[model samples]
Target: MALRQISDAICDHLAQPEPARPLVLSLHGPPGVGKSMFHLLAAHALYNRQPDRPGLRCPGLDCAGYKVLYGMDYTADERAAQHSALRAALLDHVRHAPESLLVVEEYDKLDCPMRGFFRQLLENGPVANATLNKAIVVLESNLGYTELHDLLLRAGDRSKIAPEEAQRVLKDMVFSRWLAEGCEERSDTMKMVGMVSFFLPFFPLERRHIRQLFEMRLAERGAELQNGQLGALQWDEAVIDFLTEKVDFEGDFPIEGAKEVATLMTRYASRPLRLWAAAQQQQLAAQQQAAKKGGGSDGGSSSGGVAAAGRLRVADGGMELTVEPAKALS
Candidate 1:
């Protein structure tokens, strides 16, 4: 549902004959439920035709047309300076790349003044003669996570939660939060809230999602191996299952979602493969040195001719990664 809404919003914004205002979206959810990942993948999709391969290599803040701002980075002591800097940067960004993406993470952490800044920006009003009409603004916040989680618990399936209910609940929660957090000017805040095109709720990730994340991380690890000319890392469903079980779950959902996936993959999957690759490279180098000094193979094939593939599996009640040398051609 979130994906569909975001895609439609993007397409509609791009198709606009004369875009009156920027497409502003408010993403509400718990931590680690793929809110950040979703925006990154969305940004990648907009800029390039590359498949959404899981890894941290997405063209996010580095992209010319994409900008990300963290609310926490704006310290209270330097609030005025930080706010001006942010305002200037955003103005410049929109002027340079009209059709762009701007993601504000930790939106809930921004103080009343900063909230006012965003409120002004989202109004589509003139800002030094520059407007955000052609930009897509995403405000990521954890404001309505409790409501979202409760809805998920009741619904069982995330898709079971009605979009209308989700939007109503999340928007009400966000508005109430802003009020409680001192959104000084009530009328302006209300107008800012009304300008948002969509309030997408990301629910807790189920076991299936976590399993898919594990597979993606493993695939990314394999890509790393292949890119390094270390053949590939092989794993079956058993390996995936083993890694999936490593995540801690509460009820039907993972406690931490996919947050710890990278750490777990590095420790259990990527580390052993990396060690093997390093050892294999060292051995191949030694063999090449020996061959150069009259230590040639009897079969006339170079000792370094074979590349090894690392295979991971469940073995002896634990995990095992074994490197196998490729067969030489006849």
Candidate 2:
């Protein structure tokens, strides 16, 4: 819901008249909590529509006016070169399309010099050979996550914490942390922080949220049975419960959120399907052999037998896996 709200805000900004200041957004969240995905989704939403139409282009090309940079991938030794390249690329894109969106991921990992460059852009409302006053800039980082978690815990209910309150608390925490890291009071990083138009905090997902994500993934994989046919593979409720329990038992809550649960499910779910498929094959072989030996009267049942034998069912009750004989194709 927070993601959707943030997406809506970006969309609203896109629909507005060109303003003097670029829409600078800062996304703060822990790892694997969908911050990167959010950026990709926002790009797709903004630039992927009717790309070949006039004044629209695909984001993969240099002229598309959408750029994504990863801070961690560039180090201090190459900072100057990377900074020049970044400036050139950004200016080129903005020159082509004044309403461009520049996304910088792992913003906290950027060196002070690069941070200063960004600070200059934000302060001046433009960059080399381009006016970014009508563009949108997104900076994503994991900074202030622990402090945010503490704030949420103190509130006892995330919903009870107003958005303004969360943003204020996070801003103070980020500023304090920057100061503690030997940054000057008027450091570039702090200036950039002060210039952010919006501070979107992505909270750690709960068990229910993780379960919903798993269900969505399953739906995407067509993992559902329909009309007594193998329309899609389905997960048993017991298995889901087992996965949830295992996730709960894992040490820190929301350390990796849905990502960790998805990984666990992927690791554990495949073996059962393999075993089940093997058992089904074995059963079909036995049934065919019995039929050939005149053990059953219906020879035409082999087609139905194939369908029935191909059914693979996996269930885990109380962490105990139960593999039964194949049922109908349903």
Candidate 3:
């Protein structure tokens, strides 16, 4: 529901031309709810022809031509440089430039005061000389459900602002952003929404979607998926159920936990070194025992069970058998 809700909002918002066909959508959600994926889908919906029909118009930005700079920690120089670069890139991407939409995921890093810089560009209308071309901007937020209330309050939002201590911090920030030295006013509602901030409501991510994310990632890696191939790698119904139980069906996931598991797998047992390592380590102890006796090689152990019972060898005069304890060694 979280992604679908976002998709629906973007599609519906731009369905009609709201002046210059400007459709600026801002989405706020917790991590792992597929916000990026939803944005890609929304882009496709903008100018896409149904697969059932050919010679279709797929309305969306060419991602290769687009530059998506994640606004995270940046020095002032880094921020300014990237900001200018992004604007320049956008102008170049949209040739004869039909309005290209810029989806700024995690936009809070671009302080609210400087937000008006964007406001001015959109509201005043980009000049032919300006770096930005005719483009709609979609500014997404990192505000998770828990963080939304605080952020809205920080943005001078009063009606739904909570009364918590965290809420107080947001309220103070809002005051700073709104009343601060750098903040500017915008008379244009559409431009304000695009350049500044807006709210995106939350929805539940059903259990099916959670599993789908993993499958989707694997598929992108060229893993051929059978009906149960997704289940084969590190998860099954039991695991999914156990995971779903911890999630807030509204798509807010145990993101930390997921990262932890992926980290553990990568660090300990990821591909090119899984059971083979464990088996090799296990064989080491057996090899030492055989070395003490010193008849069979480090790997060849006929004392153990079937594993040590290596393959059979046939000679001209008689039949002799040799067994390899470790299949990896064999």
lDDT of each: 0.77, 0.66, 0.45
lDDT of 3 by residue, 8-100 (tens): 645565565534434455555556545665555555554452433455333323433233447544676677776667656655654444556
Cα distance off (Å), candidate 1, residue 258: 0.9
Best by lDDT: 1
TM-score, every prediction = 0.79, 0.75, 0.50
Q: Which ten residues in a row have the lowest lDDT in candidate 3?
A: 306-315
Superposition TM-score, candidate 3 onto the true structure: 0.50
Query: Candidate 1: RMSD over Cα atoms?
Result: 4.9
Among the numbered candidates, top TM-score falls to 1
lDDT of 1: 0.77
- List model 1 lDDT by residue over 50-161, tens digit each: 5545553445444578788875456568888888887888889888877778898988788877777777777846688777888899999877766887998888778788
Per-residue lDDT for 165-192 in model 2, tens only? 8788777776766666664455655776
Answer with 1 or 2, whichever has the higher lDDT. 1
TM-score of 1: 0.79
- Model 3 alpha-carbon miss at residue 180, Å: 6.0
- Once fitted onto the true fold, the runs of candidate 3 whose alpha carbons sit more than 4 angstroms away are 1-5, 12-18, 44-66, 77-83, 94-96, 112-114, 129-134, 147-182, 185-198, 202-253, 257-330
